[model samples]
Target: MDTPSAAPHRMAPSGGCPHADNARLLARGAVVPVVLPGEIEGMAVVGHEALKEFLAHPDVAKNARHFTALREGRISEGWPLLTFATVQGMTTADGEDHRRLRSLVSRAFTARRVEELRPRIEELTVSLLDDLARAAASDGGVADLRHHFALPLPLGVICELLGVEDRHRDRLHRLSGHVVATDIGPQQVIAANRELVAVLGEIAQARAEHPGDDLTSALIAARDEEGDRLSQQELIGTLVLMIIAGHETTLNLITNAVRALCDHRDQLELVRSGHATWGDVVEETLRWDAPVSYFPFRYPVRDLTLGGTVVPKGTPVLAGYSAAGRDRAVHGSDADRFDVTRPRRGGAVRSLSLGHGAHYCLGAPLARLEAGIALEGLFTRFPDLELALPEGEPPRHASFVGNSVLTLPVRL
Candidate 1:
């Protein structure tokens, strides 16, 4: 039970590699003190057991109501990470509130419903592959798989599912960059949130006028057995969360899988030779390199000691998913190695990449579905795809929360 007597490390706001950062943090302690982008002090749970225990602990909560700093006005609305705390969605709700908010949209993400979207996912995958083929035929014989295939396939599916008009897609994408970003200032964060809210609010209004056979409209008209409906703010927040989670995570998942397979040709061959399935590849990629590195704003409802550090009640804690995924204590000394043949008894991945327990990502099934299909279709179409970086490796996305490269340029 070591306590922090030293100054906390300031986590990189951008341009920091998750693996390197996690390794450094884990070396310090399972629970290490850190400073967020806005110089906000917090603790990061990087140990697998500690993180899982804390994440599922009865006293741990996701709602901002338990955040002492915010309640005391030590943190303000203009903070870049304030959206995570103040958002009125499942991501920021707890207890009955969380259940109610999650329940309203749970059916849309159930395995059965997600599986039903397979055809559409497959169709989108093929179409994107075709687009990639066209781009590969151009000068340099290179294509940015991130922008072309990895991004659009899931974005298209999520946009259509939410009844978001194509006109809003580009703007939503740009705004979402601001949302996930930790590098921006207060004013930029405020502007991004306002515009995002307005755009989703417009979609909600349009759906109200002309109901469609989409999730957005379904949510607008949905009610539980108790007849509870999503309030206006919850509606917009839900839309923002769904749009970001639906596409952003899956896109990164697909891109990371490709990069991993390319870097480890042996693993790629195993998949090609039928020694492992695309499903195996997807799970391994998630464990080896998670899509989301750090998710914020989980507060302890009561004082709790995790990995030797006593986190006071109402202190914000970040669930270090990327760190936990490759935790050598849980996954063994070979945890850092990418092995597609990693065992999955009962098809369960022993990693916290999709989270755990109560707040496990509702979109997990859909994200896996999209990644598996996208990877299979991508490699099947261009088996010879290789990294086309003239400079050793492509730069990563400028966000601590997102764990992916900026561009996955590949020679087709």
Candidate 2:
């Protein structure tokens, strides 16, 4: 598809409206499907009905063979795939096991706990932005936001939490990106997993030797408990998850917030004026353009009809969690537009970005806290901040699992 010397890439053909794509795939009443045309071949499901079948279908299991010989062709990269073997061994373990594993760290992400961390998060955000401002001023008033702030906040937070040294943060970034992004192939995932696992093993081993006030130490305590707690392997997996989830996901959150604020200067100024709160910005950013464009583990457990079309069992049904945020039935005509004042209707205690139902993201609270504080602190420190290079198309992440921006080059 390209010249011999050209770099290879994936192409997603788009219709003008993103909301329509999802509504078309699934919905009823005031329905509008937002789906990419021709992306999935031989699929009769289109628009509202399709979307309903996906989210509410019991038969549509998240579990599927990585390699499926579908009439549409081979469908690899399903739940429990080899790439995630390192993160979730029994990826299909949907019920008790999943809950138990998630519970080990879930307590830390409760509203009270996350709210307690807000002050610290705000301080960290301010510090990072101050550093960014200095760098921008020194570099002729231009700094890459990703390099200066987006990457470091989560990196430092997780590193401090996990007991990983600052010396090897670079390696973590490379490994994290390789596994999360499709730009790298299977071999890269294996190597990164092995290396990261080895590092976690070492750190975990040390925590058992010399405990500290950190997540690794906490995990060590959990593992050493006489009763049924975390195993050594779970320790490794959670550490990897924490580092990857903390950094990769939050990186996108920060970038997406920056992108949204820049695109809507009026909203940014209003937030700056205290007309809206940090929670509003965080909520709007998560909705306007989710850091995760797709849900990784959602599956069809049985035959289901979204809109009206029947999606057969074993069909790899992926929900656009990112897309679902902006539906008319859910959000109305202003769904496509980023409006911070929009009532918090969907988050009935659980934000859609974190997801819904049994397998909700455990890190939601911490993530929201981090983003809210990060945005507020950064803006407070640099009121005149604007993108260093605002023109042209912004960089997007090339990965199936994450909705991330590769780089956010900006001027403070």
Candidate 3:
């Protein structure tokens, strides 16, 4: 294998999205590979095969190891993410521990299971829009949809799934954001994680004593069938993971979908026309301006070559799915534009934001439905709405995992 000798490239001047910088790298055919920081440590992964190699390697662990390597001056942190709850379970390593853990909760994500929740999702979407419409009417005919609807629908659904007290919904919502905030110091994330864990510990304890039909209850019930289905710690960790993952991914999807609709009026019109349809809106929203812009971090297990460069073992790598989605070699010019009617199986829609290989997001289907319902109702309910903020002034949050607009002011 060719050991790469060239210096790594700094991650594109991180704009709201990394697309422009990624376009520049794609033009050169080979991206600036991830190397040590003075070397380019994490987030600068080389060409595409590096993505496959890093994901599929047997020795590559998906926790903070990849990050530690980058901190140690290893470029290519090979995709190690800091707030990985799935990896804390089995989405990361091999062996019975991983297999046993993942199996306990996999059933709830089955295609049928997600389908079962569809009616409730539609009801929830409509209910939120009703509130948004009322807000618009009361507030000089405008409202910030992000605050009123985009954030709540998903948070509500996740609360239902986790069996969290509906009253705790707002608290969990605030806590999840603080836990994942990009502006905060490490201490903040630590405090958020600890507080969330403590809160979940209580919930799990309560569920253990008094189970219900939710995922938490289901896990407790599974104990009889699998015997060692979960420990108290495992239950708390998984709940926290599900809650945060549920909040993080779905909240961003709703926010980004609204932002995309405001950006692309024709697509907006198509959805308004109905021939374009809601499915079109959701897929378009996801592929157009992905909410989760990057993949969870990954670790390189062995010395490897990607796009002809050597990536040493144990380094962390940030695969920019947001960048990958618009790759010139892969998506062509259309990749830059949003096309809802496009087939879902091919092209840029297949971009790796929900990730690929072993760690593909388990909650993806539910998230899609939630966003589709939310956006479909949004335009159908308020086709007359107009943006209150100028296009240049749309708000944004700086996050390593999710980049989202903070508020989308609009008038109906």
Candidate 4:
């Protein structure tokens, strides 16, 4: 593997075109200093080795409350969405707090639990495919596969797992859109977050009064050997985390995979010819066009040196997962090429798309299972699936965090 070039100091765009901005910085080297939203200065760590190390480092913390700037009141809470990303959740917690939250949630969201949903996932996939076929027939043999198929499967599965009421699904879905929207203003973000929190809080309260077999109910009833249980706030946060992380990322995974397959005819042919499995397509998509381009900000507790760069304390850093996924040093010079038959490294699923270290995605198994089933069913049902806009370009969600197509029009 070759070493990344020296880190560069650069100013990231204040807003708009974040993907392009990130791509420019990533091209500079593995580690670069950047100014994020609200003029927060930090380092962007790219490449496989550098990201892995950054994620695992003890001093490179996730708790924003512990950030030196926040502690000393150097910066106002200008970004309301930052609260959603870094408050009372496992995603932003550190040490014992994170361990306790993760432990409780893990009991309710285990691999066996996810595996049990496989049959139901398959059933839902078939149902959605049927709906897509009807939609295509009505729309002159063309339909937005993303809306009809990719988006709904994971949303339905997650709602079922969390026991979200059927009536509330639409509201939850809309609010979630605002939560992840890159163009939304700070006030709008806060408004969306407030509504989402209220809904989750109500659901948590209801689950407390009357428990059920769903994961939300299980979480409400869960207790450690020490009798430690989740607080009401913790419960709400956990449910929100599960819903957003569970379905949103999986939706992108499916959409991105489908788009990749459609764009690369040769790779698509390999899978269509039965020379590669759907699982291969899913993994390659994950590595080539990661669903979450950058993991949310991780703040350093103190000044630290990482990947040959000195990062100041309280700086908000993000692991550039999208760039690392295609780093030539790690995946070879052909890393930029999308190849479904790319050999697995030691038979381990190595992409940072799902995350790494202590904060590794708890919902990874479920996401992978859902995507695999979705792709297999989708292609098997519609053997003639092709991009409706082959001559046109697909628009991306305007998010630094989310790397998803706005719509994937297809002919079924």
Pairs that collide in candidate 4 are none
Model 4 over residues 321-353: C-alpha lDDT tens digits? 887888777887787788988854464437887
lDDT of 3 by residue, 197-297 (tens): 77877777777788888898887666645667666666666776788788778787777777777767887776667657777667666655667665545
Compared with the true structure, model 1 gives a TM-score of 0.96
Per-residue alpha-carbon lDDT of model 1 for 247-298, expressed as tens digits?
9999889999999999999999999999999999988888889999988879
TM-score-wise, the better of 1 and 3 is 1
Tens digits of per-residue lDDT for model 2 on 295-328? Answer: 4444445554555344445444445656666655
Cα shift from native, residue 281, model 4 (Å): 1.0
**Highest TM-score, which number?**
1
- For all predictions, the C-alpha RMSD in Å is 1.9, 6.6, 4.1, 3.1
Q: Candidate 3, which ten residues in sequence have the lowest lDDT sum?
A: 73-82
126, model 4: CA deviation in Å?
Answer: 0.4
Considering every candidate listed, which one attains the maximal lDDT? 1
How many clashes does each candidate structure show, in the order listed? 0, 42, 23, 0
The lDDT for every candidate, in the order shown, is 0.87, 0.62, 0.66, 0.78
Where in model 2 is the C-alpha error above 4 Å? 1-81, 89-92, 226-228, 344-351
